[model samples]
Target: MTTSTGKGSIVVVTGASTGIGASTARALSRHGFHVLAGVRRAGDGDTLRANGIEPVILDITEPTQVQALAARIAADPRPLHALVNNAGIQVNGPVETLPMAQWRRVFDVNLFGHVAITQTLLPALLRSEGRVINISSIGGKLAMPTYGAYAGAKFALEAVSDALRREVSPLGVEVVVIQPGGVRTQMAARGVATANHLAAQMTSDQETRYGGLVQAVNSLMDSGTASGVTSELAARVIVKAVMTPRPRTRYTVGRDAALLIRLARVLPDRALDHLSARSLRSHHPRTPTVGVLSRLRVGVSS
Candidate 1:
């Protein structure tokens, strides 16, 4: 698992408590990087350490933690080789009825958090000739009904990634975006809950127009929850992008990610939206399997 770059290279990965972040931490460790696995909770950090990783307390949404990470890495003499910004959350519902609070919550973590952490660590990255890997989603490229908040934030992230790549490439820093279609994670559960929460907050007429849509979205999340990519597989992709001599700017994962993105681009917005609605409806369950799918979606991956 060692690389020619040397085992002492320093790597910083955010949201290492679960899903892609946790998997990336372990994968990078196997590659011999001294990983500073960042997690919001101390208990989660302890779990990472138990698995042979060095855990650091970090919440990307917190300014102090982000600054501390920068300070600590800058003070250390070891070259900072990579930064994996993998922390994210999902919120789903009609944009019109979506609570402003929920919208802000999603963006705060998915967009602003990534930017804050990256900006804070940019100096170290420049000094080490390192790369920044943003763990975005297929939603960043395609818009679907009921995922307005989540998709909006990811869209912003992709734009920011594009800008950062241009801004930092001259400084010997690289920016890579990983756009995964569907990897089973807590994200789906959060999206579903957001749907219900938003529904409750809506007016009767608004709910009538969109309640079925939200339920359909939850159903689609359930049906699509089938065996997908594992976080380990995603981590492998990140490791390749980070360790490769000439990394690609964008990497798309999952079976349908590429096809869907292509379709979304070629098809008219209304057509694509209708298609997504149909797909959502087809996945909603009429039986007990619905419950299973919902639970499975909370942590399953592509």
Candidate 2:
């Protein structure tokens, strides 16, 4: 009940309103750890309240909310054991088309928000010799056609994790990055919806250039999620990272993630391009309903 696994102690999981975060909170609580589940709304918190799970209203992008989380931990009787930075938003648009404002918003929620919370809670994590579990995507290593903002932020997060791990492991804290492939989360649905919304606002020229590609990527997202692992399964990997004595610095959540990470390591840049373009081609429309695959795909030849 006392040492670092948070067993009978405390752990915090953000974005607990649904998906992997919610599943992780539940799994940790079941392991006898007290879980502070972070949600954006009180109703969501109410839905998660249970024996060992306490739901906290947290929007990681908000400074006030982040400080409140730190304060709550400061007052708790149990030592804080881990901070799961699992909250994220998915935004997809080509580099030239995504608005500047949207780009900032993506970084704010995906990258900056995690950094702020980690900085605020470092004292407690260090005190407990706890772990910081960051949920990254396979997109972190493999950037696709329309994932300009999302993947850029994830790539930065991966680098930050490396730097933080080097700085903190010597200080008794562990930073672990979780690379998930297409886990069947609501994120894919939300991402596709957002992508379509942005596509609708594109100029005629932008639409002509990107519209078909966007549609193809959306289809790919849907198929990927349909074939993805469950949130509970993904949570099991996170729990392992939390419970293991000397966990690996990074873990891939599913088979797709593991294979893709391997491919990223070995595949050349041009090879990745052709692989990506071919994958999208299956979902691409025929007869040039919008911009035809031939027009959309530039570098990859038939």
Candidate 3:
């Protein structure tokens, strides 16, 4: 860990190699924060350094790397002002057929890894009265078919954030959740790849059982990606969560995110189900009859 004579409030942004995390690190640096951008690869570190942000080699899911990050920050003369847990992976597949390993991997990165980092950094954060900002997704609130693994992780993250907020508020450390609807990021591409790979791996019987539903869900995901907001927009929201005098407990970043949140809160379960099914139907009109029927069944069961 190299120490630098940097200026202003200090922040650590995990998964700063690309997408929202990278944008947030850059934005925070521009806003006068001495940003420590966490990356998993050496090349990514070079990229961040070239852009004038300090880079820390960190893979959040790796316990030793996470510990090294905490130790380095502790040793630094500058007080840590914020910790942003933005590192996450997406696993898109049917819930019934999704591998347990993939589910564990998603939760490890999205929820457990963040918890470990937060716990490790609490001392520094408490001393600085800093903030912990979690990057979640609109899927955190609304779960769609084939997005169960990612959404499940985010949902758990939200619950963890709420609990951490209540527990740490008295200590002057704030915990916030930023849920972005659909940000134009590498994550969407990764999700598409994951979905495609999973679809390819399915046996004939599994395909017959889950193929239409997966297609419907993938179509919905494509729609979200098409209308996604910019990563910089999400970064701005993150900066607000960190810099605001009295930070909000949660913020929905994109306009689409805000709308989805509103609908999730106001609409009854059946209404949401019907709307979701209809949207899926619009995409895969012919083959996804099973998808619609399954959705209706789930709605009725609920």
Candidate 4:
């Protein structure tokens, strides 16, 4: 795990309490980088500290906390070597029914928050000619049904990462995006739960119209969580991005992600639409006719 340039290097990893973030932090620490693991909760910080990485109490969505973290790092003599923006949340629902609040919350955590942290740390990064690694998603490139909020934020993040890369490269700072497919994580479970909750809140008429779609989305999420690549695999890619002298502008971390990206590039829009429709229909528990017929039968019996 050791890296030629990573020995004693200082790196900050946000959302380090679990999944890819946690794995990346641990991997970097083992590779001889001094990892400052940022966690939202004090208990999470304790967990990181127990693992031998320095824990910083940070909530990327909160500007004060981000500023405090930056100030603390700036006070140290060592220049920051890397900043990994890995904190994000997934919210799933039909765009028409999804709450604007949820969309804002997702963006706050996934896009705006990371942008703030990156801005705050730019000076430190510039001083060391460091790298900014943004953990985006396959959804960022190819939006999926019921993932509008999550995808929107990720899409925005991709654009921001691109702009930042161009702007900071002149200053010797590298900006890269890591797009991972379904990685086995709690996020899948949370997404499924959120889908269910959102579906439950729908009116009867709305449910009649969108229930199958909701079920399909939940099914997809379950499969993703069950079959996704390991977070460790993602962490390996992140470490490579950080340690490589010349890194690509973006890296797809999982096989599925790479395939999706390829498909997005090569497939015609009409073909992709057909594929997406097929996937949804295949995953849906009940066909539209079956659902309608079942409801009619229940109505007649009553």
Clash count per candidate: 5, 0, 0, 0
**Model 2 bad stretches (over 4 Å):** 1-5, 287-302
Q: Please report the TM-score between candidate 2 and the true structure.
A: 0.94
* Better by lDDT, candidate 3 or 2: 2
TM-score: which is higher, 3 or 4? 4
Q: What alpha-carbon RMSD in Å does predicted model 1 have with respect to the real structure?
A: 5.3
lDDT of 1 by residue, 140-164 (tens): 9987788788889999999999999
Give me the overall lDDT of model 1. 0.80
Cα displacement (angstroms), candidate 3, residue 129, comes to 0.5
Give the better candidate number (1 or 2) by TM-score.
2
Candidate 1 vs 2: which has more lDDT: 2
Expressed as tens digits, the lDDT of each residue in 183-296 for candidate 3 is 888888788768766676665667778777777777777788879988898998998887886888999988988998899999999998998888887666485444444554
What's the C-alpha lDDT at position 73 in model 2? 93
Off by over 4 Å in 4: 1-4, 50-52, 287-302
Worst 10 residues of 3 by lDDT: 1-10
Task: Say which candidate scores most in TM-score.
Answer: 2
Instruction: Return the lDDT, model 4, position 62.
Output: 86
Worst 10 residues of 1 by lDDT: 288-297
lDDT of each: 0.80, 0.90, 0.84, 0.85
Candidate 1 Cα misplacement greater than 4 A, ranges: 1-6, 50-52, 284-302
- Clash list (residue pairs), candidate 3: none
For residues 1-302, could you state the per-residue lDDT of candidate 4 as single tens digits? 11347675789999999999999999998887889899988898777784438989899988889989988887877668899999988889888888889889989999999999999998889888999999999989888888889999999999999999989898899999999998999878888877776666666777777778878878877887788899999999999999998899999977889998899999998887887788777787755634543554465556
| Highest-lDDT candidate | 2
Instruction: TM-score each candidate.
Output: 0.89, 0.94, 0.90, 0.92
